[model samples]
Target chain A: MTSLSTDAIPHAQSYRGLVARRLAILVGLAAVLVLSVAVDVSLGPARYALGDVLRTIVAPGAADLQMRVVIWDIRMPMALLAVTVGASLSLAGAQMQTILANPLASPFTLGLSAAASFGAALAMVLGVAIFPAAVGLMVPINAFAMAMAASLLIFGLSTLRGVTVETIVLLGIALVFSFNAALALLQYFASDQALSAVVFWTMGSLTKATWGKVAITAAILALCTPLFARRAWALTAIRLGEARAAAMGVPVRRLRLEALVLVSVLAAVPVSFVGTIGFIGIVGPHVARLLLGEDQRFFLPGAMLSGAVILSATSVLSKALLPGAVLPIGIITALVGVPFFAALILTKGRKAW
Target chain B: MVSLALEQVGARYGRREILSDATCAPVAGGGLTALVGANAAGKSTLFRRIAGQLRGPGIVRLEGAAPHDLRYMPQDTGMSAALTVYESVILALKQGGGGWRLSAAELAAVDDVLHRFGLADLAQRQLPELSGGQRQSVSIAQTLVSQPKVVLMDEPTSALDLFRQYEILEALRRYAEETGAVVILALHDLNQVMRACATTLALAEGRIIAAGPTLEVLTPEMISRLYGIDSRVERCSRGCPMMIVDGPSGQARAG
Candidate 1:
């Protein structure tokens, strides 16, 4: 199939044009990202300058040991960690829209985030996290399994022989309530420290960002990114109704199966690590739409970057915006994202939307 | 050979049988064959079966080539609000491949069709921005680009204005004549039936009440029985027929 060589591209020029546009957005975002990292690293501890932040990163020994450790070991990983989680949540949001055919859907709204959080909660709160003498993939294995199960149940309920957007939303709402109820039950049984851990986990923070988790998240994201971009078409096609998609030779069920699995897998990883970060999934794509226009190709890339940009900025702003202390990353994301999307709603209203 | 034929096709969802012993055969030459019936008369059920998106009790044979050569555009013509008109058609073209990518020439051909249907200006607009009529138009346009041997459409004009309705039906007619591709449309409007259709299939309660030449199959009795309303079909000038629904005033012509 790869041999088909993408019959869509007329020549390298058109292909290059799309690639150039995508790369331009990526590059611009990357530069801003680097700047955000510097700003974030310089905020606390030794308060390195922008120049020192760079020197501390690359020139290492040029800076004192303490500044280097703070910059390299702490802030830099947090920034990268924030971007990865942000990308995953937004992409999951986009996929949720496609699968359910509802504009208002997000993994959090649909309960995937809460469900994964519950999985992680079960491990920590209940001490049911099985780390074995034998081979085991640990929390991620359980989280992904539970997340997939949660999503499949939602998919099954929303879908009869035929599905409507309203049905999916209602099912998602039901799942969210029930899943949160289950979390409450788990919380009720937890020890005080475990409960505090679960509660703080749901608020989402970059504080837990570690080198190991960043590597795993990046590797998984890099592998899945192409498929995520390509999914825009399938998503649009599926909205036409899975039956019609099948008639159009889309292998509708196969596509849905793979997408559901992929989105669930994607959702589980980040939410397991970052907990239920809100609005990134909902607002990232909307921001992408406003900036790059609504073409899914543009929308997907736009969403990915808008997500990274917002989270990167939030990572910096969370530390600096407050007088003396850091805020949870999710709090800043929602505060910024809510008002931006609110303005979008007010200006457009439901009809314009 | 029939372009699309269903034999003894019976369909049901849960406990309710929507269609039973329904058989449909379109002329091998290919043009619009309008399926007319009142709401819930098994028109949609038959359409789904013909599209092969839904399986029923019959073997659907495709003539002049592969059985998989037909496509169906459902009533909703499901569209992602996020995609562009250009992206929508490209995906339809890519039906055979896991990815739907249209080459420049292919895209140009699709753009031409979109242009003909007055969708050219909105090619880059998001699907969410389109009106119901425009969305339906884009859906119909996407179906044609695959160059399928047969295209099945449900409620093709149920959402459009009079002018857009005529525009869409006329476009379908032109495409059919140009490519000899059969078009099956389940229609709510019978005037469109006489105007654009060469054949008519009237179905009710899972049975094909009548199916044949458009003029003969769509008698006043046939329509009244299908719709459960008092109506009449008559021969009109210009070698075209028309429907007159009986009302309190007198005999009224239904355009």
Candidate 2:
């Protein structure tokens, strides 16, 4: 009896300590993300010193006109885009993994990226705009439209009475194949210039990022994060399995549908703006899971920060590796993400998946 | 007293009825009740019907408690999450309500259950790292952490070892007595039901055959009808009730 009483205080204290530790890890990831973004802004074809970059970012009017324009206009947009897009995609993937109960479920693996690619290809190759009014922004608009269509398809099918999580994931894979085949068909009949445009879009780059794109992505992230935060406990409970979660009064079907819609929007916006950046969705969540476990209060922010740090750091590597020439950001993400993710998986004793 | 009464509750899958007319007396709280049946006898289906996971034909009335005041623990305890034992129990306790932060009382409740289930030592261990029996114990803690007015468990101890099973049942009985909760367990072992549960509800082919005191409801004839087995209920040297199965029933073999 005495032992039970004595143990209570320490157990409560230890759980609090665990929460503190997870918070510290989240802070650490955010710090790394900020540093990497700074480095990403500093390095380019026309490189500036780190101090000048920091100073210019802090006080834009103090820097010279050329430095200000170059940092703010060119490099800063790409860096900020990396953070927002990375955060958005990673958050999408984390929730997808949660709702689907599949470790491999992500924006890239489950056909959102493929659908975006096909949508962009249609706009580029055939000069066909799915939404006729957006002439100036046909590619992104069409891409978003198609990605939303595919996600809604999954979401619609999942709401049926007997469709399981595995069925949803399988349906996602089927969508991946269907979209990829259509993309291939579009490529076959494309003009040379249009073909190159489609190919470049599929490779995924941040070079053409604009401030407007960054704001939109960040706004979407802001909107979605709070919605997810409100259901943090429910999302965490879901990882235990569907029946168990439902038994806990979680309204499992409705929650899964809600998460799917939000995730679709989260994934669609970024892929539309920045093309198909693949590995961030899959790797970011895994990294956060490895560090912080699956508590959504911590896992949600942790995934966003880890993704931002990874993509920001990848942006730095893309600029630094080929000095005057920036490599395709997609290529570098897979190259850097696979080995780093493999190492984490191989080394970690805890089962992340 | 908290009580759960099912009146003509019926549940079915597509084109096939699983449970029909499962009526039970108003079982008041503060003790263990066993729901026993053979495979495909609709034990889990009945629990689901009562838990509101499935839409059935009849009424499940609860007295002195709302629907949310009941928790059902399904048999399958397969967990692959990266959360620790402490966090998983915390997850269950914080299921429907509460904010991001854990209250001191909430933490204390979780700790109390963990200590009761002998899981305080494995508090920091990850879910995927624990053994099968340990995972079952963790699931029990998850079910009871909320201290619900009515608790339904479907084969909760199937994965537990002998000693662990006894210890968990003892903890559960204490919980029901202390909290005045209606605790119903779907168990395959008739002997364990005889030892731990005061009341037993026997089902055969999706129909409630008998419901009353465990000893009266678990007669050799009832066991034969439910499980197609010839069994005898005997007292051990320590005066504890045990079931001694003779063989498959002659009627079952002929049919």
On TM-score, the candidate that comes out on top is: 2
Candidate 1's error at A200, in angstroms? 3.1
**Model 2 spans with C-alpha error above 4 angstroms:** A1-8, B253-255
lDDT of 2 by residue, A1-353 (tens): 24454365788778878988988998889888878987889899986788998999999999999999999999999999999999999999999999889889897767899999999999999989998998789999999999999998888898899999889889989999999999999999999999999998988899989999999999999999999999999999899988888888888889999999899999999999889897999999999999999999999999999888888898889988887999888989999889989999999848745
In candidate 2, position B208 carries an lDDT of: 81
Judged by whole-model lDDT over C-alpha atoms, candidate 1 comes out at 0.72
Candidate 2 at B96: error in angstroms? 3.1
Cα-based TM-score, every candidate: 0.84, 0.97
Pairs that collide in candidate 2 are: none
